[model samples]
Every structure is written in structure tokens, then in C-alpha cells.
Target chain A: MVIERASVTANELIAEGIFQMNVSAPKIAGENPSPGQFINISVIDSWFHPLRRPMSIAGREGESLKIIYKIFGAGTRLLSEFPVGSFIDLLGPLGNTFELTEGATPVLVGGGVGLAPILWFDETLRSNGIDHTTIIGARHSGEHFLEHCPKEGFILTTDDGTVGIKGTVLPTIESICLEMENPKLFACGPEPMLKAVKQFAEKETVLCELSVESYMGCATGICQGCAIEHKSSSISEHSYHERFSLVCLDGPIYNAKDIRFP
Target chain B: MSCNLTVEIAGVSFKNPIFVASGTFGYGLETQELTDSSSLGAVITKSITRHPREGNPPPRIVETPSGMINSIGLANMGVERYIDTVIPRIDEIGTAVITNIAGFSIDDYLYVMEKLEACKAPICGYEINISCPNVEAGRMEFAVDPELTGRLTESLREVTKKLLIIKLSPNVTGIASIALAAEQAGADAVSAINTVFGMSIDTQSRSPYVQTNVGGLSGPAVRPVGIACVYKISRKVNIPIIGIGGITSANDAVEYILAGASVVQVGTANYKNADTARSMIDELELYLAENGIENLSELTGGVIPNE
Candidate 1:
């Protein structure tokens, strides 16, 4: 991984509390970071906030990287206030990337800022002339960003009846999988939501890939702080201890069958 | 005149005095690409146990005011895998390497130590980790009691002729007594202090932030505690002191040296910047030169008191 000063190219509020930040980081971009990989951004220069914040790559262009984040705490609040031309120390292209298998139609599922990686994955598939479906869920219309995505094969859902379907993303995922042949699932979101998706895919015996999230101390695998439990029956290559996988090194992207919610 | 950063601990020479604390730098391979880890005086590998441990359940870590609380529960790949996967590549680090051993019992520690002794890796010494607070097996019992600390140190000292350093915890009532016990029991040096026991609660959920409810705290918040422990232990023991706890800058390292620490380790700050310890090497030398000091060892226990 490389640490570089990535200057803010743009930071725009796409939804109520969500923002899409663009930075010019040739050093990180030169490594050819893929979808599902993340960059740990150093927040304010203070002792209180010592650890860097890990943000997934939402998109990438020539030498620019895009990150979508919601202001959940003091760190993100400060990140939102960075004016254009300001530089942020970034350490990346970290963790494993999403695996796209041949003959399997990709079905991307996301919610909130978790949609960042999914959006990038959708763009990647489209650019490759590959066929895929995108499903997004949010709390309300004010929390959704449909305009930023392609109109075709992109579905949006809301918890309240302010958008496409008045429910969670599970029903749409089920319906889409029932009709498609060789459907492989790709998902990312808050822990509870990802757990739900994991369970749904496992009951149906469908192949699924999930981008997990955790409170990381060192996004470089030194601290061993981010622990994701291993599924007892599943064989894993990265489970050195035989029971846990560190999200920073083993994955942010994992085959759902290899991991279990703990 | 030039400043010398090299330090000799128990007859083992280090290129500098900036060592990356155990459990913070992993096997010294995690951040090789981000920083020149070879620039460090030494690297202490994570605590290796007899059997591979899965560690504790999440959320394992949470950030507090100026520090963070962590209950990793000594999660590691066990001693066998460490030797199989890490030891052969250990020389790539290009610095003095000290292996940190943690176990639930004296036998467990000896078992791992004996195995390492047979491997013939370029390890200069062993840092006995009897201070990890997150695990239940040992409950860090050896760190709190001087007699227990002495017994553990004495047992491990008989196994190897290499340098032996006892890592002390600040969560005890008499930390100096424990350090003295290790020194009397044949420990070559002592490192103080490990993390301070701490906890945090979330008001909204009315629950602890970390799953373990309590964890070991390390960061800028614990720097004073570390310095105090080092000063106290230095007064009690004649052996060299390795100061650890939230050390981030050369200025901080100097403070530890003044308090009687022969060397310092960068802990939580490594998370903020992996290159922290490597950068401090030059900064520390510059510090000595600017002050007209020729040797860093002279600064150890150099704190002046008011008349």
C-alpha cells in the first residue's frame, strides 16, 4: 500500500447526510485499485482522532478516486468540511476485491453509503459490456441517489412509500434471483442489513460475495482489531487462526459462505 | 560531532532506539510497502501462544478521547505457524528482532520459547508478555504480583542464554516492585508499561462500546502513565528500560528517555502513521545534535528536579 496526499477535487452533498468526495491521488490510483478495495483517509490533525477513517472506493478515473460517506460522527463531520484544494493523507489500495465469475450474472445489492462499492461494480460491469442488475434501498426519497446511476436495470426501494417500492431490498433480491439463471449476489451495507442478506442467500444456497465493515485500528493488518468470524463448515485460505479473518488483510470482500455474523 | 542512535541491550546491539511495540506492528511484514520498517531499531512480533487463537468477538476496538480501548484477547496464528510462515522471512526486516511470547501458563511460555530456540532464527532476545489484559487464561496475573512475575521470569531465563526483557503492566498498585522482581530473577531488562485498563460506554444504547466491556487502553492519554511507570521502575531496577505507551513523536521519546527509558516503542500512533517509528530515528538524532548531545544513552534518566 502507498500513502499519498490526495487533494480534494470535489465534495458534493448527493443526499441529505451523504456526500461524494473526489480526490486526485495518482500514487494510489497508479496501483490500479479495484472495486471493493478501500482507502484509509487521515482525518483531522489532532490527538483525539488518532486512527484514520477507512472509506471504500466508490469510483476511480485516471488519477482520481471517489468516496461516498455519511456524517455519522465527529470524524466524518470534519471530512465533510474539507474545502477544495485541501489535501488528505490517504493509505490504500487496501484489502481484497470483489470476484466476478464467468457465466454468472452479477446481482448487486446495497443500502446507504454502502452503495458506493456497488455503484463502482455496476459501472465496471457496464464498461465490460457485461449484463447485471443494481438494487438500492434507502430510508426515503431524500436519502436515495437514483439520478447518479444508469436508468436501465437499476431498481430503487425505500422503507417508506416515498420511492419505487415501499419495503426493504430483500423482496426485490428474492424476485430477481428466482428468474435469473446462475445468479451471483454482491452486497454491502450496515452490519444488520448485510447479516440479513447473508442469511437469505444461504437459505437458498445461492453463491454470494459481501464487502464487510468493522471498526479498524490499523487498516494495514497490524493491530488485528477488525475481526470477522469464520463459518465453521466453510474452508478458507485466509483463516490462519482457523476461526477469524481480519477485514483489513483477508478481506473487505469475502465469499458469504466463508464468513458468519458474530 | 555526530549523534549515535545505536543502543546495546543485554549485549545485543540495535541500529537505533525506536522499536515498534508488539501487537501493533504484526509480523513486521504488514506495512513493509508503506514505510521502511528496516529503519527501526527493532521489531517485536505479536504475542504468540501455543495454539492458534481466534481472538474475541467484535467490536474488538473503540476510540476513546485521546486513546483507544482494545480487547483483542491475544489473537494470533500460534507459534508453529509463526515459525513456518514468518521466521524464514524475518531477516527481510533488516533490524534487530525480538519475539514477544504470551501464554496462559509457565509451561505454555516455555513450550513456545523452546520451539523458537530450536528454530535458530536471528532473534536477538525474548520479551516476556505477561501483561496482556484481554485474555482470561492468564488474567494477567503475572503482571500484578511481584512473586508471580519473579517466578515466570526465572523460569524463562533458564531456557535461553539470549537477552530476556519482562514487559510490565501499569494496571497494578506497585508496578516498580514487579519490575524489580523481574530484574532480580535474571531479566536482562524491563519494558514499561503495557496498556492501562480502561472502559467506555455508549449513552444511547446504555452499553459498553467494546464487546468485552473493558479493554486495555493505549494512546496519548496513557503516555504520562507510561513515563511514570518507567521512572518508578528505573529507580527500582538497574536494568535498561524500554518505554512504551502512546509514544508518537521524537519529543515523546525524549521524555521517556529523560524519565530513564533507554529506548521507546511506538504503539497506537502506528495506526495513525505506519512510518512514525522510522521517521523518529532521524528526528531523535537531530534532537540530540541540536542540544549538543553526543550520545542518546546519556539522556536516559536525565530529568532535572527543581532545587
Candidate 2:
């Protein structure tokens, strides 16, 4: 992927603390950016904020790509202050893309800010004329942000019973999984929810792919900042010593069963 | 008028003074799609040892306010594997390639160098990686001791006809004396400050951020210490010094150059931008051109001390 100095075309709050920014990243957003990969972005002229914070690619419209992020650290805190005409430096389309088979029915699942990456996943499925279902959950009604998505075949859940469902995405996922035949799942969200989704997907015997968010230094492969452990690797299934993989290189997405979530 | 960024250190000429620090840039192949590798002065391969290394466990790096600490434990394939698979790709980079060697003892260092001497690639020289703070043995152990540093440099000087540059650790009390020991042992040049020893704990988790609690800290956090080492060593010895620590922009490179470094390697900044080394090369040249400076050799050791 290329490092592009994409101008900030639009930056506004979508939910309580979540923001959706449209950036002019032609090469980085690419003609067809796969769903799971993300962008490492930072404030235009701030060398003080040295590391580029990783943001999931929410959507791509025409010449610009959309990024959905929460103000978690110093980098994001600085980015929230940029005006509409300002520029945001980005290095991306990094990490591996979500894998979809030719005929596996798509089932999109997202939780909180994790839904950002899956927004692109849902769009890709819709564009491919694939019939799929979307299940999104947030902490409360104010945190919910899928108003622009289609009403039919969509499930929304909130913790305080202010949205589509009162509980987490787990119930909606179970019911949907039971209905859809040979559904292939794509999910990104909180660790606890991902753990539940992984369990649900496993029990239901459907294919599952997940994206994990780890604290990072370099979104590239060089710095071993973002590494996730696995039960087994390609080199060894039972080898105790080498059970690790880099989130920046091997994946931001892996099969539901491929990784053991903490 | 065209600017000449060419620099000759230890009888080896670099297209510029921008060498990518060992390990931070990872053999320089990953960023080929982002920028041309041949643009930088040189690409120093990751530190390699006699046997393969798995490195430290998970959480190898942690982000500080302005920099990062990594206990990457010289995580790399053995020397033979690197020479067979990675070096050829490095050979194609068409720029100066300096192999950074790491070992537990001088014999381990000698063994790796012997194998390196056999390789027919157009390698300009070797940078002895005696300064890494990530490992439990050999790296810092050899670097902190002036005698060990001298003996290693002296033995390495016996083998191979290539230029020898000793990388010094900043963990020692007297950075200058260790550098002098290296100079006396016949090193072509010395690269200062290979990460100051550091550690950070995740309070909430009640554990160390990295599996190995103590790692080598790099980036802008270590910049002053690195410059100080270069400055201190510059006075004690006359050999060229390759200043490394946390160099982000051209001004930082010039800071090291003014402090008496003939060359500078950009380390932790590469994490922020993969093309940092190339960008710094362009920035340094522009700084020279705009300032009406004809050559870069004049800037080396330009800093004047106060009486």
C-alpha cells in the first residue's frame, strides 16, 4: 500500500464519541479495497504525535475513503481538531483483507467501533449482489450509527434496550445463523463480543473471519508491535514455542477458529 | 548547481548519509512498494546471529509519548538462512548494504563474519551490532565492556577485508572510553547509541508491557543520549561516527552531524513513516542546497565546545 497525504474532505461526529471522516486517498482507498484491512493515519503537520494511529476503513466513495475512529489516544485526540480543509497523512490499505468464498452466504457482524471495518464489508457484499444480513451493536442508543444502512435484513442491538434489541449481538447472531444456510461470517468489535461471536460461529458450524484491534507502533510488518497469539500456526499445529503472528502482517483478519481470542 | 550528498566513511562511499538503522527497517524489502530502496544512502540488514532466533515473546514493542521500546531480541533467521534468502534481495536494492552482526561471544561473531566473507554479494562493509539492549546475553554484555568491545573489534579486524564499523551501546557509564577502545582496536568507524536500556509496565494489567520487561528504547526519546555519545566519542577518537538514535527530520540529522557524526542512521522514525530514510535524504540535501552549502563533509563535527 502507498502512503498518501489525503486531504480531509469531511470530518464530523457520527455518534457520541465516534467520528467518520472522508479523505481523498485514491491509491490507498484503491479502486476496490477489501473489507478487513485498515489505514494508519495521523495529523498532517504534527511530528510530536509520531506514531500513526490505525483506523479501520469504513467506506470508500468515488475518490475518497471513509475512516471511522474513536479518540482513544494522543494521535486521535489531535486528529479530532482538524478542520474540513486540513490534510491527514495516511499509510495504508495495510494488513490482510477479509476472505470470502465464491458461494458462501455473507453474514456481517460488528460491535461498537468495530463496525467501522465491517461497513466496507457490507458494501462489498451488497455490490456483489450477495444476499446477506448485518448485525450491529453498541453500548447505548446514542452510540448506534447505522441509520444510513438499509432497514430490511439489518439487526441493531444496544445494552440498555434503546435500539432494535436490548441485549448484545449474540442472540441476533444465533437466530440469524440458524436461519441462513452455509453463512460465512465477517466480524470486528470488542474482544468480549468477538469471543462470543467466535463461540457462536463455531457451535453453529459456519465459516467466520474476525478483525482484532491491538495497540501498535508501526502498522507495517517491521515493528513487532501488533502480535496476536494462536493455538496453532502454519509451521506447527502443536508447537508450543511458535504460537504467535503479527496483526500488521499475517492479519488483522483471521478465520474464527484460526485464532484463540482472549 | 547539483548537490552532492555522497559521503565516504571508512573508505566506503554512501550515496548519502541516510542509513536505515538495523532492525527498524527490516532488510528494506518490505517498503520497496512504497519507495525506492536505492534512494537511501544504504540499507543495513537486521542483526543476525549464528543460530536462528525466535526473539522475545508477545508484546515486543510499546509506544511511549514520543518513541517506542522494543525487546525484539535480535529476532532473525540464522546467518546461513539470511545469506541464502534475504541477502540476494538486498543485493538487488542496488544501494550500499551493510550487514549488522550480533553474537553471544567473539567466537560467535567470528563465525558469522567468516560466513559473510564467503558471500559474493557487493557488500560494502559490516556493522558490528554490539549494542542491542533487548537480548539477555552477548549484545549489551559485549558492548558495555571496553575490553570486550576492543577484543571483538580486534578479532573482527583480523578476518575479512571489508570496512568494520562497531555499533556502541549507550548503557555504559562512559560512552567515550568504550568508543576509544573500539577505535584503538582498528575499527573503521563506530555507530553510536543502539537504544538505551528501558522498560515500562502496564499498571492496569499488573505486568510488563513486553514479555521481556526490559527492552531497548529508541526514537526521539533517545536522541539526546545518542548525540551525546557521538559528541563524546568524536572528541576521544578521530574515526568517523555513524550517529543513530531517534532521527525524524533533516534538522535532527544535522544535529547529529553537527555533534561530530560523519553519518547518521534513522531508526525509530521509520516506524512513523516507512519512507523516512529516503525523505530525510532529500530533506538533508535540500537543507544543504538552500543554506548555500556546497558539500556535506564540512558539516561533520561542526559543533564547537564552550571553554
Which candidate tops TM-score? 1
Write one digit per residue (lDDT tens) for candidate 2, span A21-116: 898888785645677888887663645656778888888877789888888766777788778988878888888888877778778889988999
lDDT of 2 by residue, B59-121 (tens): 788777677778776767778887888877875677899988988877888999999887865
Candidate 2 chain A weakest lDDT stretch, 10 residues: A233-242
Q: What is residue B301's positional error in candidate 2, in angstroms?
A: 1.7
Off by over 4 Å in 1: A148-151, A234-240, B132-140
How does chain B score by TM in each prediction?
0.97, 0.95
lDDT of 1 by residue, A114-135 (tens): 9999999989988988899899
Leading candidate by DockQ: 1
Checking candidate 1 for backbone clashes, the offending pairs are: none
